[model samples]
Target: MKARSKRLMLVGGGVALLVAAVALVLSAFQQNLVFFHTPSEVAEGKAPTGKTFRVGGMVEDGSIKREADGLTVSFVITDTAKVIPVSYRGTLPDLFKEGKGAVVQGKLEADGTFRASEVLAKHDENYMPPEAAHAVEQASKAAATVSQ
Candidate 1:
Protein backbone atom coordinates (compact mmCIF):
# COMPACT_ATOMS: atom_id res chain seq x y z
CA MET A 1 0.00 0.00 0.00
CA LYS A 2 2.67 2.52 1.06
CA ALA A 3 5.38 3.57 -1.45
CA ARG A 4 8.19 2.32 0.81
CA SER A 5 6.42 -1.01 1.34
CA LYS A 6 5.90 -1.41 -2.42
CA ARG A 7 9.59 -0.75 -3.06
CA LEU A 8 10.61 -3.31 -0.40
CA MET A 9 8.28 -5.95 -1.87
CA LEU A 10 9.64 -5.43 -5.36
CA VAL A 11 13.25 -5.80 -4.17
CA GLY A 12 12.38 -8.94 -2.20
CA GLY A 13 10.68 -10.47 -5.25
CA GLY A 14 13.68 -9.71 -7.44
CA VAL A 15 16.02 -11.32 -4.95
CA ALA A 16 13.85 -14.42 -4.70
CA LEU A 17 13.70 -14.77 -8.48
CA LEU A 18 17.47 -14.48 -8.71
CA VAL A 19 17.94 -17.15 -6.06
CA ALA A 20 15.52 -19.47 -7.85
CA ALA A 21 17.34 -19.00 -11.15
CA VAL A 22 20.68 -19.81 -9.58
CA ALA A 23 19.31 -22.93 -7.94
CA LEU A 24 17.83 -24.18 -11.21
CA VAL A 25 21.04 -23.61 -13.08
CA LEU A 26 23.03 -25.46 -10.47
CA SER A 27 20.64 -28.40 -10.51
CA ALA A 28 20.82 -28.69 -14.30
CA PHE A 29 24.57 -28.48 -14.21
CA GLN A 30 24.74 -31.18 -11.57
CA GLN A 31 22.71 -33.52 -13.78
CA ASN A 32 25.21 -33.15 -16.60
CA LEU A 33 28.23 -33.46 -14.32
CA VAL A 34 30.22 -36.66 -14.72
CA PHE A 35 32.44 -37.52 -11.79
CA PHE A 36 35.64 -39.51 -11.91
CA HIS A 37 35.61 -42.71 -9.87
CA THR A 38 38.56 -44.80 -8.91
CA PRO A 39 38.48 -48.57 -8.97
CA SER A 40 38.09 -48.49 -5.22
CA GLU A 41 34.97 -46.41 -5.44
CA VAL A 42 33.57 -48.50 -8.27
CA ALA A 43 34.15 -51.66 -6.30
CA GLU A 44 32.40 -50.09 -3.36
CA GLY A 45 29.31 -49.51 -5.52
CA LYS A 46 29.62 -45.74 -5.46
CA ALA A 47 29.66 -45.47 -9.26
CA PRO A 48 26.63 -44.15 -11.09
CA THR A 49 24.50 -46.90 -12.61
CA GLY A 50 23.53 -46.61 -16.30
CA LYS A 51 24.74 -43.01 -16.45
CA THR A 52 28.02 -42.10 -18.10
CA PHE A 53 30.98 -41.33 -15.84
CA ARG A 54 34.76 -41.56 -15.75
CA VAL A 55 36.88 -44.27 -14.18
CA GLY A 56 40.60 -43.73 -13.79
CA GLY A 57 43.34 -45.92 -12.40
CA MET A 58 46.24 -48.09 -13.45
CA VAL A 59 45.75 -50.96 -15.86
CA GLU A 60 46.45 -54.05 -13.84
CA ASP A 61 49.46 -55.99 -14.98
CA GLY A 62 48.60 -59.20 -16.86
CA SER A 63 44.93 -58.26 -16.88
CA ILE A 64 44.66 -57.00 -20.41
CA LYS A 65 42.61 -59.25 -22.66
CA ARG A 66 41.91 -58.73 -26.31
CA GLU A 67 39.14 -60.38 -28.24
CA ALA A 68 39.92 -62.30 -31.38
CA ASP A 69 38.25 -59.53 -33.32
CA GLY A 70 41.17 -57.32 -32.13
CA LEU A 71 39.01 -54.26 -31.65
CA THR A 72 37.42 -55.34 -28.39
CA VAL A 73 39.69 -55.18 -25.39
CA SER A 74 39.05 -55.75 -21.75
CA PHE A 75 41.28 -54.85 -18.86
CA VAL A 76 41.19 -54.53 -15.14
CA ILE A 77 41.85 -51.15 -13.60
CA THR A 78 43.24 -51.04 -10.10
CA ASP A 79 43.76 -48.41 -7.45
CA THR A 80 45.65 -50.91 -5.28
CA ALA A 81 42.69 -51.50 -3.01
CA LYS A 82 40.27 -52.69 -5.67
CA VAL A 83 39.89 -53.44 -9.37
CA ILE A 84 37.26 -52.56 -11.93
CA PRO A 85 36.75 -54.32 -15.24
CA VAL A 86 36.56 -52.16 -18.33
CA SER A 87 35.77 -53.04 -21.93
CA TYR A 88 36.49 -50.84 -24.90
CA ARG A 89 35.69 -51.58 -28.53
CA GLY A 90 38.06 -49.34 -30.36
CA THR A 91 41.69 -48.62 -31.05
CA LEU A 92 43.30 -47.79 -27.75
CA PRO A 93 45.64 -44.89 -27.28
CA ASP A 94 49.24 -45.61 -28.20
CA LEU A 95 50.17 -45.05 -24.59
CA PHE A 96 47.73 -47.61 -23.28
CA LYS A 97 49.54 -50.53 -21.79
CA GLU A 98 49.53 -52.77 -18.79
CA GLY A 99 50.66 -51.14 -15.54
CA LYS A 100 50.02 -47.67 -16.97
CA GLY A 101 47.46 -45.14 -15.82
CA ALA A 102 44.33 -44.59 -17.89
CA VAL A 103 41.06 -42.71 -17.72
CA VAL A 104 38.00 -44.14 -19.45
CA GLN A 105 34.73 -42.37 -20.01
CA GLY A 106 31.61 -44.52 -20.24
CA LYS A 107 28.75 -46.10 -18.36
CA LEU A 108 29.01 -48.78 -15.77
CA GLU A 109 27.16 -51.86 -16.85
CA ALA A 110 24.83 -53.95 -14.68
CA ASP A 111 27.38 -56.73 -14.84
CA GLY A 112 30.05 -54.50 -13.26
CA THR A 113 32.07 -53.77 -16.39
CA PHE A 114 32.62 -50.23 -17.60
CA ARG A 115 31.72 -49.85 -21.29
CA ALA A 116 34.22 -47.28 -22.42
CA SER A 117 33.40 -44.78 -25.10
CA GLU A 118 36.77 -43.10 -24.93
CA VAL A 119 40.08 -43.90 -23.37
CA LEU A 120 42.93 -41.57 -22.44
CA ALA A 121 46.06 -43.24 -21.29
CA LYS A 122 49.12 -41.66 -19.75
CA HIS A 123 51.76 -40.73 -22.29
CA ASP A 124 54.62 -41.28 -19.89
CA GLU A 125 55.33 -43.73 -17.12
CA ASN A 126 55.46 -40.93 -14.56
CA TYR A 127 52.34 -39.19 -15.79
CA MET A 128 48.74 -39.60 -14.72
CA PRO A 129 45.68 -37.44 -14.86
CA PRO A 130 45.39 -35.24 -11.81
CA GLU A 131 42.09 -36.74 -10.78
CA ALA A 132 43.45 -40.27 -11.17
CA ALA A 133 46.56 -39.37 -9.19
CA HIS A 134 44.47 -37.95 -6.37
CA ALA A 135 42.28 -41.01 -6.35
CA VAL A 136 45.30 -43.29 -6.15
CA GLU A 137 46.69 -41.24 -3.30
CA GLN A 138 43.43 -41.49 -1.40
CA ALA A 139 43.26 -45.20 -2.03
CA SER A 140 46.76 -45.66 -0.71
CA LYS A 141 45.87 -43.74 2.41
CA ALA A 142 42.81 -45.88 2.91
CA ALA A 143 44.77 -49.06 2.39
CA ALA A 144 47.33 -47.92 4.93
CA THR A 145 44.64 -47.18 7.47
CA VAL A 146 43.02 -50.53 6.94
CA SER A 147 46.31 -52.34 7.37
CA GLN A 148 47.05 -50.43 10.51
Candidate 2:
Protein backbone atom coordinates (compact mmCIF):
# COMPACT_ATOMS: atom_id res chain seq x y z
CA MET A 1 0.00 0.00 0.00
CA LYS A 2 1.08 3.59 -0.66
CA ALA A 3 2.60 5.48 2.32
CA ARG A 4 -0.09 8.20 2.22
CA SER A 5 -2.87 5.62 2.13
CA LYS A 6 -1.32 3.77 5.06
CA ARG A 7 -1.09 6.99 7.11
CA LEU A 8 -4.74 7.84 6.44
CA MET A 9 -5.83 4.35 7.46
CA LEU A 10 -3.93 4.62 10.76
CA VAL A 11 -5.55 8.00 11.56
CA GLY A 12 -9.03 6.65 10.79
CA GLY A 13 -8.46 3.66 13.03
CA GLY A 14 -7.30 5.90 15.89
CA VAL A 15 -10.40 8.06 15.59
CA ALA A 16 -12.64 5.01 15.57
CA LEU A 17 -11.02 3.65 18.73
CA LEU A 18 -11.40 6.99 20.46
CA VAL A 19 -15.08 7.13 19.58
CA ALA A 20 -15.65 3.59 20.84
CA ALA A 21 -13.92 4.33 24.14
CA VAL A 22 -16.04 7.46 24.67
CA ALA A 23 -19.21 5.55 23.89
CA LEU A 24 -18.41 2.82 26.39
CA VAL A 25 -17.63 5.30 29.12
CA LEU A 26 -20.85 7.21 28.47
CA SER A 27 -22.94 4.06 28.58
CA ALA A 28 -21.46 3.07 31.95
CA PHE A 29 -22.12 6.52 33.36
CA GLN A 30 -25.68 6.56 32.11
CA GLN A 31 -26.40 3.28 33.85
CA ASN A 32 -25.23 4.73 37.15
CA LEU A 33 -27.06 8.01 36.81
CA VAL A 34 -30.14 8.66 38.95
CA PHE A 35 -32.71 11.42 38.54
CA PHE A 36 -35.05 13.20 40.92
CA HIS A 37 -38.82 13.26 40.50
CA THR A 38 -41.75 14.58 42.49
CA PRO A 39 -44.59 12.49 43.86
CA SER A 40 -46.93 13.95 41.29
CA GLU A 41 -44.53 13.13 38.50
CA VAL A 42 -44.09 9.57 39.72
CA ALA A 43 -47.85 9.15 39.97
CA GLU A 44 -48.16 10.28 36.38
CA GLY A 45 -46.01 7.32 35.28
CA LYS A 46 -42.81 9.29 35.09
CA ALA A 47 -40.88 6.87 37.31
CA PRO A 48 -39.95 3.68 35.52
CA THR A 49 -40.14 0.43 37.47
CA GLY A 50 -36.97 -1.36 38.64
CA LYS A 51 -34.88 1.70 37.74
CA THR A 52 -33.17 3.80 40.37
CA PHE A 53 -34.44 7.37 40.79
CA ARG A 54 -35.11 10.00 43.42
CA VAL A 55 -38.44 11.34 44.65
CA GLY A 56 -38.75 14.72 46.36
CA GLY A 57 -41.77 16.06 48.16
CA MET A 58 -43.22 17.10 51.46
CA VAL A 59 -43.62 14.39 54.10
CA GLU A 60 -47.38 14.12 54.42
CA ASP A 61 -48.73 14.96 57.83
CA GLY A 62 -49.96 12.05 59.98
CA SER A 63 -48.62 9.52 57.50
CA ILE A 64 -45.53 8.37 59.34
CA LYS A 65 -45.74 4.90 60.84
CA ARG A 66 -42.96 3.09 62.62
CA GLU A 67 -42.84 -0.66 62.41
CA ALA A 68 -42.66 -2.88 65.47
CA ASP A 69 -39.04 -3.57 64.76
CA GLY A 70 -38.41 0.19 64.96
CA LEU A 71 -35.78 -0.02 62.29
CA THR A 72 -38.20 0.39 59.40
CA VAL A 73 -40.45 3.37 58.91
CA SER A 74 -43.20 4.02 56.39
CA PHE A 75 -44.51 7.36 55.32
CA VAL A 76 -46.35 9.06 52.52
CA ILE A 77 -44.66 11.80 50.56
CA THR A 78 -46.88 14.30 48.83
CA ASP A 79 -46.35 16.89 46.16
CA THR A 80 -49.84 18.33 46.62
CA ALA A 81 -51.08 16.65 43.44
CA LYS A 82 -50.09 13.11 44.43
CA VAL A 83 -48.68 10.95 47.19
CA ILE A 84 -46.14 8.14 47.18
CA PRO A 85 -45.71 5.57 49.93
CA VAL A 86 -42.08 5.21 51.01
CA SER A 87 -40.41 2.64 53.21
CA TYR A 88 -36.96 3.10 54.65
CA ARG A 89 -35.10 0.62 56.83
CA GLY A 90 -32.58 2.99 58.34
CA THR A 91 -32.35 5.95 60.60
CA LEU A 92 -33.67 9.09 58.99
CA PRO A 93 -32.17 12.55 59.15
CA ASP A 94 -33.11 14.58 62.19
CA LEU A 95 -34.58 17.21 59.92
CA PHE A 96 -37.03 14.80 58.36
CA LYS A 97 -40.43 15.80 59.61
CA GLU A 98 -44.00 16.06 58.48
CA GLY A 99 -44.94 18.90 56.15
CA LYS A 100 -41.30 19.37 55.20
CA GLY A 101 -39.59 18.82 51.87
CA ALA A 102 -37.50 15.70 51.49
CA VAL A 103 -35.72 13.73 48.81
CA VAL A 104 -35.49 9.94 48.75
CA GLN A 105 -33.39 7.81 46.43
CA GLY A 106 -34.27 4.23 45.59
CA LYS A 107 -36.37 2.04 43.30
CA LEU A 108 -40.11 1.60 43.16
CA GLU A 109 -41.26 -1.76 44.40
CA ALA A 110 -43.79 -3.94 42.54
CA ASP A 111 -46.32 -3.10 45.24
CA GLY A 112 -46.31 0.57 44.15
CA THR A 113 -44.25 1.63 47.14
CA PHE A 114 -40.89 3.35 46.92
CA ARG A 115 -38.14 1.48 48.72
CA ALA A 116 -35.82 4.25 49.76
CA SER A 117 -32.27 3.33 50.60
CA GLU A 118 -31.44 6.91 51.39
CA VAL A 119 -33.45 9.88 52.55
CA LEU A 120 -32.47 13.56 52.58
CA ALA A 121 -34.43 16.35 54.10
CA LYS A 122 -34.09 19.77 52.59
CA HIS A 123 -32.16 22.39 54.55
CA ASP A 124 -32.03 26.11 54.06
CA GLU A 125 -30.22 27.68 51.14
CA ASN A 126 -26.57 26.53 51.41
CA TYR A 127 -27.22 24.75 54.71
CA MET A 128 -26.46 21.36 56.18
CA PRO A 129 -28.17 18.60 58.19
CA PRO A 130 -30.71 19.58 60.86
CA GLU A 131 -31.12 22.91 59.12
CA ALA A 132 -34.69 22.11 58.20
CA ALA A 133 -35.75 22.33 61.83
CA HIS A 134 -33.83 25.54 62.23
CA ALA A 135 -35.51 26.95 59.15
CA VAL A 136 -38.92 26.15 60.50
CA GLU A 137 -38.06 27.74 63.78
CA GLN A 138 -36.76 30.84 62.03
CA ALA A 139 -39.86 31.11 59.93
CA SER A 140 -42.03 30.83 62.98
CA LYS A 141 -40.13 33.65 64.65
CA ALA A 142 -40.40 35.77 61.51
CA ALA A 143 -44.13 35.22 61.36
CA ALA A 144 -44.53 36.19 64.99
CA THR A 145 -42.43 39.28 64.47
CA VAL A 146 -44.52 40.32 61.49
CA SER A 147 -47.74 39.90 63.46
CA GLN A 148 -46.44 41.90 66.40
Leading candidate by TM-score: 1
Question: Considering only N, C-alpha and C atoms within 3 Å, which residue pairs clash in candidate 2?
Answer: none
- Candidate 2 residue spans exceeding 4 A from truth: 125-148
**What's the count of clashing pairs in each model shown?**
0, 0
Q: Evaluate model 1: give its lDDT.
A: 0.92
- Per-residue alpha-carbon lDDT of candidate 1 for residues 32-144, written as tens digits (9 for 90 to 100): 89888888888888888999899998899999999999999999888888998899999999999998899999999999989999999998868999988888899999999
Residue 54 of candidate 1: its Cα lDDT?
Answer: 96
TM-score, model 1 to reference: 0.78
Top candidate by lDDT? 1
User: Global lDDT of each model?
Assistant: 0.92, 0.81
With a 3 Å backbone cut-off (N, CA, C), the pairs that clash in candidate 1 are none
TM-score of each: 0.78, 0.73
Instruction: After the best TM-score superposition of candidate 1, give how far the Cα of residue 79 lies from its true spot, in angstroms.
Output: 0.6
lDDT of 2 at 121: 86
Per-model RMSD to reference: 3.6, 6.9
